[model samples]
Target chain A: MNPKIAAYLRDHAPATPCLVLDVDRVEQNYRRLMAAMPLARVYYAVKANPAAPILDRLTALGSSFDAASWEEIEACLAAGARPADISFGNTVKKVSAIKAAHAAGVTMYAFDSEPELKKLAQHAPGARVYCRILVENKGAEWPLSRKFGCEMGMAKALMVKAAEWGLDPYGISFHVGSQQTQTGAYQAAIARVAMLFTDLRQAGVNLRMVNLGGGYPVRYRAEVPEIDAFGDAIMGAMAEHFGNALPEMVIEPGRFMVGDAGVVSSEVVLVSRKGEDDPVRWVYLDIGRFGGLAETEGEAIRYAFRTPHDGGAEGPVTIAGPTCDSTDTLYEKSNYRLPLALDCGDRVELIATGAYVTTYASQAFNGFKPLAEHYI
Target chain B: MNPKIAAYLRDHAPATPCLVLDVDRVEQNYRRLMAAMPLARVYYAVKANPAAPILDRLTALGSSFDAASWEEIEACLAAGARPADISFGNTVKKVSAIKAAHAAGVTMYAFDSEPELKKLAQHAPGARVYCRILVENKGAEWPLSRKFGCEMGMAKALMVKAAEWGLDPYGISFHVGSQQTQTGAYQAAIARVAMLFTDLRQAGVNLRMVNLGGGYPVRYRAEVPEIDAFGDAIMGAMAEHFGNALPEMVIEPGRFMVGDAGVVSSEVVLVSRKGEDDPVRWVYLDIGRFGGLAETEGEAIRYAFRTPHDGGAEGPVTIAGPTCDSTDTLYEKSNYRLPLALDCGDRVELIATGAYVTTYASQAFNGFKPLAEHYI
Candidate 1:
């Protein structure tokens, strides 16, 4: 544990687990991503961590937003972001949400099917629209291409249908599956989205923009793809596919924008054994799978643990949240070494959890109090 | 779908994927369990749902509660359950929580370690306590036999230590595990706990209460163990082990009492296909993994889905929740028959989800709001 970080926690923070936002870290991440993708309009995926302070900082730094819901869209609007600069990127949306977006004067929303277009026409007629295209890869861990996007062949038909219904179809949108580690997958998606745009233009569908929805991988663990190279490769592929004469570029970067900017701190309740065959120690903390770490899929984002008084490395110990459910183990087995003699009431901090932590991940189980957020 | 259930939803219910509690069903479940277990005192585990109406019904039925936190204790107390009838059972509790429980005049709590006992001592000195004994389980799905219990001999020592600290050391408590399928496991736990009682008595530690912590499996599907057989086997085992000489028995049953008493109604927003190669049908609903079914544990508990119109035994379909995450699938591939052609705006009911079905299961993800509870 860093002595200074530990000392700061002891002196200032409460015993409750909290989501901490560091402006310096967020600014650094934003600047670094912008430096890599200088040409593409960087839209911060507000759903990742939509805290007002973080959104305000990103807006001041000239980052646009990708909002999936009206609440998020309103959050961005309240944070001083222009509606035209934001994209209602979730392909599946409610009629009320679309109507609200239209009333709020937001122009673009991603749509997948003929039915969605009809709903959009009823709710937000003649609204600026982007057709979300489904593209699949057999080898991807999670193929978002599976069911989200519209087919390339059907894109023209959908656009025609949109026109017939008096709705203005803008362009195309595609989301490469999240936590994408393969750069080639993103390059392929860019090319596919670009091809769809060219096809639509050929079909006389006068497109204005192309949105590559957010799936930028935040390096939760060791094997995550580097953001800079992936961004550069995607841009190069887009240039090659659309001959650099393509419509305006938009990329939704959720985890990439704010995942590493936040930390969660909680006090240890007990250091007990999780099971018997393993005399392994458990550090039970105040947070669980509910508070922003809802990776119940077992593909949980890895977290770094630190204590306020760690003077030495402790043996392998599993960290658990206070929820009585046995499935609530945070660290199944210790990946990091920690100080020995760690007792109950010790405070620990989980690092780089800012993306989907706290308010976004709360369930009122075990009568657990929701975590409060703090900005630094 | 039952016509009455469907009509009730169409007129009285707000939408599909909303939680509905049948007060009659819950009361029947409570009465059946209490009647089945004549030898043991039923302590409804408030952590399961703890909805005020459910708590009130349980309290009215003369049931005590096993509260895991101060909020649960407060919930029980607010519902007219006397503090003396509730046990704050989380061994490792927050100091403030312990104080709150004490202030409510909750006299007894569970303790597993000396450090936790020390903290509880500080908060509620001279509090009545039950030393948690970890029963050895060689093979059990719930290996909480791993994280919580005191080793047989260690429990004897902890009891002695508690007595020395001016704490009233009551009988023993052992949690077999939650959602336990194997009825024999309870018998094994009972025998072990009974032997521990004998050993403790030999060591001059006599206590009047013995808590076989509740792990009564709630049948979410048809394949789960029969509750009657499970209860009969456990009671028979108890009779064989201690006969009428057994200490006052306390059992904590959470899901078993309420799992089948509730239904979540949701509206299908859109039904779309992925691509040519992808054959999965995505039936998007307003309810997601985070709303009212968060305890499904990455699709751990599969609820029966039925369209209110007509669900015939016809074919298999993939059901996706409204959350934007690719992993937000409620049922990856569900086999069910529908009598009608299901389309957008159709309501679907997910059944056997009373436990952990309401406020405890919802996070504000995907803009899907939690349904308000109204007991009928």
Candidate 2:
């Protein structure tokens, strides 16, 4: 854990099962990302962690915004972001949202399908648009379902349609996947996107931008490549493909920006075994999957743990949240082992959980309150 | 669709992505459950859907509630339920929640481990307690994680210790799993619970009740056995085991009580294919997994979708929710087929969503509001 967050947790000892975030860490992460990729403009994905304090800090850092909905765009606007600096990045947009974002003066948009493109054309007339292309997600722990983007063939037509509909065919975008560990993934996606760009250019559509959507990894239980590595891979790929005529580069990073900036402080509600012979201890925490740890679904995001007895004797354990539903069981087969000294009422911290925790919370599922957030 | 809900949706024309529930259907379902399981007391599991209107109606129908947390207990109280009529049924509970529920005069607690039992002894002294035993969930569509219950031997010891610790060792409980299709599943669980009862009686603990935890299936895309079948199997097993001296029977039904009583009214945001030659069309809806169709996770609950052109020619489809995250995609491999004529901005209804829909909604995930709910 970062020293600033550690100090706050020790001094304040806020309620259990709450997220305590260091807004300073968010700025540091933002700076590190920018320093690593100096050429690409940072359009902070607001869907990652749209906390007012975090947004305010990033806004002050001159960061552009990639909003998934009008509500997020409003959040960015409230955080002092300029409308032109905000991109309506979600491809699946409602007409009302399109009208609202256009009227609010947000200039950039994204679409993958013709219907969505038409909705954008009819509602947000003459908005700058980008087409997301489906790319392989071979090495990402949380691979996207290929639900957001379209094939290259469709992309070619969509760019032409966008221009014919009087919209600016601004750029092309693709997500490698979240918690992407392999730098090669980005290289491969950029290569595919480059082919589409060249094809579109030959057809007389001068697409002027490339959006490298978020997939940068944050340290969890496993060590990941440094942000500099991703920067080098992306830059090398751009140089290899587009040479001296590179398009205006944009990177919309969600998890990479805030995933490691916060910690979830929870208390052990109970610790027991199924039987005397059972090897696994069931560690029930006050927070569970419904309590905003939805990333733990399928045990895909293995969050590291911090306990007072970390170096003490340990045993195999199955960690679960406090909700009654079994689906709320966070890690049963992930081989999580906690300290033998761990018992009921022990305070523990789920490390590196800032990005996708708070908003995924159920609206009081199993009667637990939505996760509380503390921005320090 | 229920005529009342259909009429409400037709007449009111509420915004897209809303749940229109038939509260009158809730009364009918409750009555049906009572008629089928005449010997068992009904404890409506509040975690399934704690909508105030449903609770108010169920409370008026004299239903006991199985609350997973203090908030749910409080919700029951607000619905005018007697504290004694509610069960604090979650095996994993926080110390604060235990204290609060006890202070609120709620009785009848559940515990699967010693630490939780000890907490009960200290906080809700002399409370009626039950031990949930691990049972096979072979035939349930939504099998539990085996996170809730302990081994039979452990449950036996826990019940004996309950009396030693000055609490009433009330009964033994087992859940067959949600959306259970086999009546034999309940029969097998009852036989197991009956053995526990007999063993505890011999051990001088004399546990009285048998809590058949909720697993009653609601019809979705397939047919399930009638509630009468489950009731018959349960009663038959009790008679076969205990003869004429059957203990107090109790049931906690979360899904079965209200699963099919509601429909989700949504609009088609977009419709497109991955490529021209691709066989599957992607149908994007206004709501998805984060928007409270969470039961659709892993395609466990196959909700039958109704489109404006449902009876027309159908084609293979991959259904997804309108969000930037690909994880928000609801169904991909479920082999769902939609009408060929379905297009953007078309009204669609997801049937059998009355339970486990509203509360599972992510709090403005991707800036989309938590699902709007209407109980007519």
Candidate 3:
């Protein structure tokens, strides 16, 4: 555990299974991103955390927001962000939500379907809109398959339709999936966007911006390249594709910005061996898949776990949540190991959980309280 | 859609994507269970659905509750249940939660480990305790692994420890997994319990109660044997094993008691094909995995869906929740077919969802509101 986090936990003695976010680390991560991609505008994805303190800090730092719903827009606005800085980033939106977003003075939007384009036309007339192009998200930990984007043919048709409907076909946006690891994924997606941009321009639609949507990976259990490497590769791709006449570039990073900034302090509820001959020990924690760590879905994204014992003898153990539900088990497939000395009341700090943890926690499964979040 | 649910939605016109519960249906299900298992006391599992109206109706019917947490015990009490009627069903519990339950006069508790038995002995002295024994939970749709229950040796030791700790070793309990289909699963579990009981009796431990833990299945897509068949099989097992004498029988039914009683009416947000030639259409619903239908985990529990256009030329479609996450896609492996005429704003009634839907909803992921439950 970070000494600061340990000290804070000791001082406050907040309830176990609570999230502790370090604002100083968040600001540092933001600065790191800014330093890496000096020319790219950063639109922090609000769905990652959306905690008021995180939003306020980012807003104070003059960061824009990539909002998926009207509530997100309202949250960003409430955090003192300008309306123009918020983009309705979700392609599939309710019509009423679209109208509400327009009423809230948000002009930018994203769509991948004709029906969604028509909704935008009816609700937010002449709004700046982007068409997301589907790309092969190969190396992303969370591979997004045919969920948000459309093909080149559909994109071209949507752009033409937007122009005909008096909506500003302003840009192209695409996500290379969440916790995207490969730098080549961005380069390849940018190339596809470049082709689409050329096709749109030939069709009398000159797009103004290219949104490199959030997918930047954070260091969890695996090592990842720094933000500067991604920036270098992306800039090289932009130079190769768009030349000197590049449009305004925007990078909406969610996990990369805040994932490492937060630590979840959970308590060990039980440690029991299944049988006398069984080698695997089951270590149950106060929190589980439903309690904000849903990203451990399929045990694909393994967060670094820190027990109170730093260098104690380690043993392989299966981790589970405190809930009665069997599906709430977290690390059955992954070979997770922890200190053998870990016992009940011992704190386990789940590192790099700032993004997608608290936001995805079930309200109350089995009457277990949703994770309480604390900001330091 | 069930005609009653359709009428309720039409009459009330609740906001899109809400859970509409039929109190009459719930009472009917309860009555059916009682008619089947006349000797078994019914203790409704509150984790299934803790909605106020459901709790109130169950409490009014004099139904006992299987509470997993202190909050659930409080909810049962607030709903007018007697403290003695509530059982602390969860084996893994916080020490503070045990103290709270004890203070609230709840004595019946379940534990599967020595640590938990010790905690109960310290906090809930002289409590009526039951040791959960590990059973081969086969033929169940949602098969629970070793997250709960202890092996035979461990369970025997735990029971002995419970008696030594001055706790009442009242009985034995076992869950045959959720959505259990085969009647033999119960018989097998009961036979195992009988053997354990015989062994314990020889050791001078006189246990009184036998908890046939919640596993009773409900018809989702496939037809399950009626509650009567399960009751007959269980009674047959009891007669075969115990001969003349029988203990106080208890059945904690969660899904079977309330599953068919509720209907979740979710709106179609969008229906779009990935490509022109792509035959599979993607139907986006306002509610998804995070919106309370999480039992769709691994697509294990397939709830029947009724679209507005029921018989209008059905086509295979992949259903997804209205979120940016790719894992929110509900049916990709499962062959889910919907009407081709289904459009945006069309309502789809998810049948047999009363038990696990509302309580599992994530608290506002991507700014989507949880399924608002309405009871009629």
Best DockQ among the predictions, by candidate number: 2
- Per-residue lDDT of A294 in model 1: 69
Q: Which CAPRI quality tier does the interface of model 1 achieve?
A: acceptable
Best by lDDT: 2
Error of 1 at B69 (Å): 0.8
- How do the residues A195-234 of candidate 1 rate in per-residue lDDT, one tens digit apiece? 7776777877777777776666665545666788777887
- Which residue pairs collide in model 2, if any? none
Off by over 4 Å in 3: A1-3, B1-3
Worst 10 residues of 2 chain B by lDDT: B322-331
Tell me the TM-score for chain B of model 2: 0.99
lDDT of 1 by residue, B222-338 (tens): 466776877798788888988788678888888888877877777888876655344455678887767656655445666777775554434445777676776667776535334
User: Which regions of candidate 1 fall more than 4 Å away from where they truly are?
Assistant: A1-11, A134-147, A150-160, A163-165, A198-208, A219-226, A274-279, A296-299, B1-10, B15-17, B133-145, B223-226, B276-279, B311-313, B333-340
Instruction: Please report, as a residue range, the 10-residue window in candidate 3 chain A with the lowest summed lDDT.
Output: A1-10
Could you tell me the TM-score of candidate 2?
Answer: 0.99
Clashes of each: 16, 0, 0
Residue-level lDDT tens digits of model 2 in B11-110: 9989989998888888898998999989999999999899899899999999999999888999999999999999999998888888998898887999
